[model samples]
Target: MDLQSIKDPSFLKKMNNEELEALSADVRKFLVEKLSITGGHIGPNLGVVELTIALHKEFNSPKDKILWDVGHQSYVHKILTGRAGEFDTLKKFKGLCGFPKMAESEHDVWETGHSSTSLSGAMGMAAARDLKKENNYVLPVIGDGALTGGMALEALNHIGSAKTDMIVILNDNEMSIAPNVGALHTVLGRLRTAGKYNWVKDELEYLLKRIPAVGGKVAATAERIKDSLKYLLVSGIFFEELGFTYLGPVDGHNYEELFENFRYAKKTKGPVLLHVITKKGKGYTPAETDKIGTWHGTGPYKVETGAFVKTPASAPAWSSLVSETVRRLAREDERIVAITPAMPVGSKLEGFASEFPERMYDVGIAEQHAATFAAGMATQNMKPFLAIYSTFLQRAYDQVVHDICRQNLNVFIGIDRAGLVGADGETHQGVFDIAFMRHIPNMVLMMPKDENEGQHMVNTALKYDDGPIAMRFPRGNGWGVPMDEDLKQIPIGTWDVLKEGTDAVILTFGTTIPMALEAAEILQKQGYSIKVVNARFIKPLDEKMLHELFSAKLPVLTIEEAVLQGGFGSYVLEFAHDHGYQNIIDRMGIPDHFIEHGSVERLLEEIGMTTEDTVAKLKSITPKKQKRA
Candidate 1:
């Protein structure tokens, strides 16, 4: 029988074991073909086909809320939940979202893109269910890597203590975007491989229960023995001791096993931990062989060969520039050491990892620990470079404020992906780093116009060991600008005047610098002389420059690729408000609403971040000043 013939939702309930196996294979095949064109999380989706199938079969969604951690693995869930038709437009503009979308379907109860959040979301839903007298299962499928996050652990602690009626399907793929790290990962690893010893131990305990009145005493003793042996056999008694009902190391790929475990979990109550073991790339050879988690997300690729169709740009990515620059500096300076919270490959620290393996720290998904650890390193006079994504660094805000900034440690934070990250959407946007980082005391916040400036900023941070320093750079390639030969360190609280004009000024930084320059050129063409200033230091505003511009009676238009609320615009406004400047001031950037997935160019244009928009808006604002003829 054709697998596609089984169309009804009820058909999944009646599917025999063999038919289920065939269906899983068909789903994998369909995913490979569909994702080749659309280009999504192919490897993760392939890994979770059986788990997703089993989940839908066991629990009714929309009524029974299911939260997918990170949501990258939800392609299988989406395909099964009546979203298969829209899969062709995955991650495309106004099309199917790569992650779970609450707007997309009723089945997707909670929208998620970041990791380690589903558990907390699940807890909240479960609490609401109790309060509302709703009878439904809330299953949160969190990966092992997500479990390492402090929030996930905190959620786990709450669930364990609250004794909420829920099931947490621990999707152990031994990875989370990158390979898993930390003590928790080691514990899960031990549990995944503890099948043999656990089985033998269980059989012995079962036999011991056959004894008489002494059987009760023997069983109690056996329970203790089993608990001790569990700790001895595996590294993870951590979950069990925390008050979760540990279930399995069951094969997630096997439909029968996954279905059986899920069925059992559905019946069980009070936070059942169903540990399902899955491979990151289950069927695809290339993904299976990939160890660095490159296949976690990708653009279009050849299905048969698993080769990426388009080549990466000849220009080095911002990540590569930071990594290469830092690696070079670290090699020369013994104080420089690199640190990341499980983002070695994404941050392009592979070269640093190879050259300075001892100096590099992959602290898993524990961003808090990574920050504090860096702070501790700083205490020892070692220049710890905590290289993290701008969004991800938000996870360590408390640590930054409390641990490092509070103590005034000399920790260098290389905040990568620091602007409007395109396809990943709002949750991944690095926009608020400046706003957040600038607010902190004893923190030097800087953004570079190009790769050359990025390199110099690294040197600047290295040389300036007075306090904590943060330098942010946007995602994707630089404008192919060559580096300075002397590597002269730019002074703190300084702005570079790219285009010297008298009428108006376009104050900007990083990726927006090029656009600002373009806007200035457009204005210059139309008889509007506009000055373009690269506002390098975001925190300590260039007061001298601002005073000079205000004295000259030039209108200032503050532009950025970040959000308008609490952004560079707000900073400029606050500065002007304090200084009492009478000249006209305007702010331009992404609006307060969450931006959707699209190309950076497309999204920028749509958000009125282009040179044309700036020029038009500036012309409309100035209006030739209405000079009397």
Candidate 2:
């Protein structure tokens, strides 16, 4: 079948199971081909092909709302909802989003990029439906890994207690980005293996019922035995006890089984938990064999061989540099330990974990718990290095402020992907960390000019004992600068002057430093003397240096790859106002809007953070007298 001919999933209802199976194959083939060019959540979408097909066949979307938790697995849903045509530009700017986007189609009822939010969304929709006196199904497909999240558990508790009419499709793929951890995973594991127990219980009950003349005390004993067996056999009784009608560990790939369970769930009263098991990368050989989540999401890959199109890095990845440095420090400092919120691989902490297994902790999608756990470790005088993504760190804001910052615990927060992370788009962008982290007291926020400075910053953060310190680095490779022979500690709240001039000063840090330098160089050729300084520390503002710049009466341009509000530039403006300095200052950064997925260069250019923009801003702020001279 021509997949593009699918305008909506209404046609799916008319097709037989055999046709649906063929459609699933075609969909998988299309995804494998298209995603190989555009790159996306290939493994996840492949896993959900049949499940999504079964869903479309079972329920009407838009009318019957279906929410995808984390939404990366919504690719198949997108395809079924007549979006196969947009695969060529998947994850590109203004193209097909990797996750569910409501604007893209009416069928996409809810947008999600963050994990563990679907249950709450589904409950809201269900409540709305009930209030409006409408009859429609509300199903939230959530994974076992997402179930580990505190919010998902909270939503589950509330939904079960409220007795809201909704079907919770527990898509158990046994992995979320990485292998799931925590006790919840263990529960799901037991449930995954409970198929045999279910069969045994069914056989036992059948035999018990067949026995003739069974009555009174013997019947009561048999009933008690059956109940005991049920309690022993069914692993989902925990969900049942929570007031949900728990259904099978159904085969997610089997259309008939999925359709049957889904139909049963829709008819059931109150809330129903339809536990369905799926393989993460069901069809593709390389993705199917993915043990470490490399196939969870990916860049473009060769279709025939499954080899990723390689662009050899000119420098080391920032994550590796920070994690390796931390590992090195852990060897010398026994007090040092590592922690991540289910991102050990992303944060490049696998090396650290392998070397110091006892000291490494992947807290499994619980950012709040991870933050507090680090704080607890810090209270015992242990140096806890909490490596987390900049976006995810938002989830632990209260913990960072109330626990770590308030107590002035020595927690080294390695804020990986601290700027505009491309491809994954707005929800995954790290642009808000500066605005969020800078406001907290005892929080020292800093970025580095390059990999060399990044390592030093990591060293400085681990060495600092006064309060919680954060060293943020952007995604991808560094500038390939040579490393120092010996690790040295950089002074806190100090800025580095990369280029010296008198007419104007360009203050920037991290990924934007090169742009600032290039802009300054451009201004120099145009007869404008511009100074470039790496304002590495976002907070603390290098008061001494600010005083010098103000005293010199030089115009300043602050550039950051972060949000403009309450960001580094705002701090600079605040500093000038506090000191009663009349220095002219201009800020260049991401505007007060969400940036979409694209290449980093394209994103930078889109937001006008390029060298040309920087140069223009600096030229505008150049001292009038100096310009006239």
Candidate 3:
């Protein structure tokens, strides 16, 4: 069958087990070929081929709600729902999204990108269905890594207590971006060894019933035997204890096994947990052999060789630059410890872990826990460098405020991928970090102009013992700038004057600095002397330097690659108002709306964060200096 012609999962109901197996092969081929060109969540999608097919066949989507927790694994779901033809434009601007989008198809019941949301979403849907007195099943497929999230655990407790009519498919591949960590992984490990307990228990029950004369006392003994079996088989017995009808250790790839378990789960009442074991990269050899999660999501790759097709690198990645700097500093400072919330690979903390395995900690997908854990270490006089992505840091906002900021602890936060992260779409963009972090008191927030400045900032952050300080960096490699022989601490609340001008001043930092420079050059050609200041420290505001600029009465324009509201620009405006400067001020940044999937350049252009826009904003404020004497 042509995978492209697939209209809906309705076709799967007509096919036998062997036919479904053939369909799975075709779907795998389609994904490998398509993702090689467009680049996407290839490993996750490939792993769920059969499982997704089984799910679609067993349940009617759009009516029977099937929520995917972390929509990266929904590529096969897309193919089954008549989206195989849209592969050419995957993850591109105005193309099929990399995650589940409700607007694309009715089959996509819930949109997702962030982890550990499906269970809660499913519970809500189930509640709605019951209120309406409707007959519909709700299924939420969650990964083993996602199951460890604080939100997911909370949802499990509520769902079990309510006995909500829903099915939870625990898709355990033993990884979430990086290899699994913490006690949950160990519990799942024991569960993996306990094979088909449901079948074994059923057989035992039938044998005991056939023995006749088993009554009262003998029946009570059978109950004890069943209770003992749960303890003997599944080490945790976690789901059963939580008031869920525990169903599996099912082989996710086997069509017959999947169908049997799906049928059983459908017949059972109350909440059911169908634990399915899968391989992260099931079909592709390179992704299958991957142990460190390089293939989790990626750029375009060579199909035959499985080699990535990337341009030659000019400098080290920002994550490597920051983590390696911390690792290098750790050699001298025994107090420096590194922590990541399950992103050892993404944050490039492997070197730090390898060097100081005792000091380094990888706390599973618990961002909230990771934040306070760092705070605890800070209280003990140990410098904890919590390396985490900007998008994920949102999960720990409460901890950041109450625990770290309120206490005024000396925790160093390495905010990785701190600007517009392209391709993964709106849910994964890092635009809101500065806006959220800047408002909190005693929080020192900054972004580096380049890799050299980044290393220096890392040194500054680790050395500072005042309060929580964060240094945000972009996703890709640095600009290959020259480095100094010795490390130095930049004074807090300072800005670098990259270009000197008298007529106007352009304050910007991080990814937007290059464009600001270009805009200034364009203005210079038009007889306008525009000053460019690297506004590295976002919070402290470099007040003394700012006063000098305001006193000179330069028409100031602030630019940042972050949310406009409560961001760097807003801070500058507030300072001017408080000082009664009356200097003509304007601001540019991400608009109030969410930015979707696209290349970084394209996104910038779309949001008018370009040299032309910057020049236009400046040109509007200062009219070419009136061709001075």
Query: Which candidate tops TM-score?
Result: 3
For model 1, how does the per-residue alpha-carbon lDDT over 169-216 read when each residue is reduced to its tens digit?
Answer: 999999998888887887888888787232545666778877777556
lDDT (tens digit, per residue) of candidate 2 on 204-285: 7677777787576665577578668768778657787787877788999999888877777767789989989999989999
For candidate 1, what is the lDDT?
A: 0.85
Worst 10 residues of 3 by lDDT: 620-629
* Ordering by lDDT: 3, 2, 1
Note the residue pairs that clash in candidate 2.
Answer: none
Clashes per candidate, residues 3 or more apart or on different chains: 0, 0, 0
Residue 330 lDDT in candidate 2: 88
Q: Could you tell me the lDDT of residue 55 within candidate 1?
A: 81
Each prediction's whole-model lDDT (CA): 0.85, 0.89, 0.92
For each candidate, give its TM-score against the true structure. Answer: 0.94, 0.95, 0.97
